[model samples]
Target: MKFHNKKKKSSRGRAKWHALMTIIAVLMVVGTGCSVGFGQNSRKNWEKNIAQETVQVEGLEGEYTLLFLTDTHVVIKDSEVSAQEAEDQESRYPMFVNAEGVPAEEQFPEWIQYANEKKVDAVLLGGDIIDSPSEANLQWLKEQLEALDMPYLYINGNHDWTYPWEYMTDMGRERYLPLLEPFMQGNTAFQRLNLGGLVILGIDDSTNQVDAQALDRYREALMDNRPVIVMAHVPFMTQSALSKAVEAWNSPVVIGAGNFGGIYPNEESEKFISLTTAADSPVELVLAGHVHFYDRDVIEGEKNVPQVVGAAGYQGNAVLIHITGTEN
Candidate 1:
């Protein structure tokens, strides 16, 4: 009986070894196949393009360095990103444009260098990570961010709303949200970062309007006594129906055409108004980058509340902002 038992034990061990080998072989094949597939689909147009100018600015209230990047406007995948290119650097974000557009990749390096020199605590990307929702590109983006020495936050823009809702499959939903899950874990509306005396918030307005719950989160974050910095991709307000109707009719009473702010409030406008009106948070500075236009508005309807716009920091058309505030 003892000899028979020893033989059975030996058979079980051999079976386990075979199973492990099978898994290893399958993984290797899959990895190799993916590599080949990626190489074949590389976009030549993007590889050659580089941004020459840099976007660098100081924070509003506290001594902080903030890097604001937006509108990559194209898909950048594993095949396009060369590890050798940034071997010495901790993180790499390849900026690109589609065919027949102005190139900015070469100028982008200057911005990175400027950030390192400024010693910014965090990097803030104001959305449109991909021209469209490409899994390979999004995954590559996640990996690139993981390499960053400092923490970074991402907001969403209109371009990212192309999730093919018509099909609405389980796989499709999974593919869409998970791509942004890395940045949307804790809060839905905005993320607040408090570094020493500097308070920074990254907000999302891609889908138009802010959720009530998300507004509450931002409100709660402001409970702490520090100057708040708001960063979002789109304007906080837009034209009302009355304003739009006036624009269509060309009424002289309507001033400044339509107000290009925050996606033309309907149901969401009330929530936004409530959030902004509630007890003034330490939000002395507001920075945004959507609409592709350059305009500065002073939001001093109330005391200690200021909002500014910074967009398109490029040659012939670029802007950088500087703000200083006291602990009043």
Candidate 2:
């Protein structure tokens, strides 16, 4: 009887050891391609806009480096932790740095410090500024970014402009515009910003629709015939290695022929990709974020312009685009 008890105890010991090993193996693969990725599904039911012939870009001024950050997903709360906070502790990454996790309010200062060190001419936020569009969340993010000494621009993602899985429509987007109005540099859906000789055309393609007004701004910027940088929350196409690999194991349903790989794959997005892939677009590079990983793809027709999707902004990863005669 004593021998039988001893054997059972030894078996339990081995089981515990195996479990520990399994957890360690998972940690090793967490940041690699084998991990599960997250992003909102595409808005296929929404009305699609047809793409018009893209205009040419005006002559651009001197060279500059643009600091691009996206998918920061900052969410701040009082000291008292909620049920969501408890889940965040386990699911959110690098909790040690974030302390509170998710938004990691404490880490904002560090990001700002890094931007200062990089001395970028401008800061571009590629959306997912907050995990959810709550008043407190938006206000906190605005205050943190407003403190930055340099000019910063932003665009909204599905996570920022609408409730999760919400329909893609003008009324849907309008509901959340107010949440971002405090920090919106321009009241329009898209911005044609001229920083000295550098021209930036930012689009609020959160719902996958770049309405007529936004497209008009894009044309005006193109009419300048200068080098323009296109900034958006999600990639313009589903043809990316990063998306293909992640979709393999993470979430297979999120990407496909018609689907834009977890982003809005509507007519506007297709047109943007088709147009910007040419030499006449003058789009030096495209910076976007949503999949929470860093990936780059060369435009099919225009080998010169590259589209760089950065890693999660919350993890201190940023893409530095050195706009020059050649691609970086």
TM-score of 1: 0.58
Candidate 2: C-alpha lDDT:
0.62
lDDT per prediction? 0.51, 0.62
lDDT of 1 by residue, 1-328 (tens): 9999999999999999999999997687666654343432221322222222222223334445566666544344344434542331122233343243433433333444555565657766666655445555566566666656676667766554344332334664345644666665555356767667666777776655554456667767777766666776655432342243335444312112234321345555455544554455466655555554444553333343444444443221223333344334
Error of 2 at 275 (Å): 2.8
Q: Which stretches of candidate 1 lie over 4 Å from their true place?
A: 1-62, 77-110, 161-175, 184-188, 238-263, 277-279, 313-328
Clashes of 1: 16
TM-score result, candidate 2? 0.67
- Each prediction's number of clashing residue pairs: 16, 11
Question: For residue 250, what is the lDDT in candidate 1?
Answer: 44
